[model samples]
Target: MKKIHNYFAIVFLFFALHAVGQTKDNKWTFGMDIAWVSYSEADKIAVGGKFINQTPRFSLAKYMFKNVVFVGSVSTAIGDNQTYTTFDGAARYDFGTSQNKVVPYALIGGSFINARILTPTLNFGAGSTLWFSPKYGLNVQLLYKFSEERFSSQRSHIMPSIGLVYSFGARDMNPRIWSSTR
Candidate 1:
């Protein structure tokens, strides 16, 4: 836990320093997330304790509108007897003014999980991003996920994650506009 916290602090500071200006174009945002996951088993299978599972996630996002982004992420669980992976596609809606340093967002998505059984999952969550500059920030999220099998009850999990995001594109482009115009 200490190591993880240190890693997060380093990433935050590195990005904060480099985040200096605003960009005007629609950019692609790439990020890496580290999460502590707690699993609630539906069957008798012992998944493991919370905080024991480390999930490293990678995500790519594009701005679809002034306040909306299309995001896709892939994640896997480590330190478990069973192999688990997930692929998700989600829409994130940013709330509050674009000039705010901290922007909150709500996410809703569908996910496909590959584990002992292949299951489709529903994800609902909310998070916030603190932008040091227009193109660089820190993102933190809490997500609740639900999956059900044909003959079994629904299984659920809580995932809390933090990460760094870097956006790439033209530096002078307006983020709120669909076209490249100042």
Candidate 2:
């Protein structure tokens, strides 16, 4: 209960501070996604598995340098007797290849996941954003997470997410960065 309150308060603060700190040259993106998480601990006999679940994921990304974007994402599920959550901080790089309105990017990062206990994991993923307009886009991502058995009981898992994105301070589909020449 208290944790959920803290999360909302932090999110509100983030938006207020971000709005005040925005500039014409800086690009910031906010994404909301419905993520499907597949746990590898599912029964070995079942072909489709039973550990897949859906949750909402929220992300805030800042365009830094030319190809690098720093991202922070959070997802939480509070059940009657359990709490599951994960926080990921990743650096996403945009490839030079972009076709029409589709732009692809790859990211690598670290994550802290709490299933029954808090544990650290290494994460890598690839995703793409399909822009319908200058300010709106559809975002999709897949993540590969790895953890050691010595540190945690849960093994590696894969998460796939699809959602909508809003980009602030963008020129066409690209973000403009402040430079000396400009």
* Candidate 1, superposed: residue stretches over 4 Å from native: 1-24, 41-52, 149-154, 170-182
RMSD of 1: 6.3
Model 1: weakest 10-residue lDDT segment is 18-27
Q: lDDT by residue for model 1 over 1-182, one digit each (tens)? A: 56855775677557545531112254467777887667755333444344334456777887776777788988776656656677888888875333455667899998877765667888999988766666676889998877654524225677788987776643332455332333
lDDT of 2 at 132: 72
Q: Score candidate 1 by lDDT.
A: 0.66
- 11-42: candidate 2 lDDT, tens digit per residue: 75565345411123545878777776677545
Clashes found in each candidate (C-alpha, N, C closer than 3 A): 5, 0
- Model 1, 73: alpha-carbon shift in Å? 0.5
Clashes of 1: 5
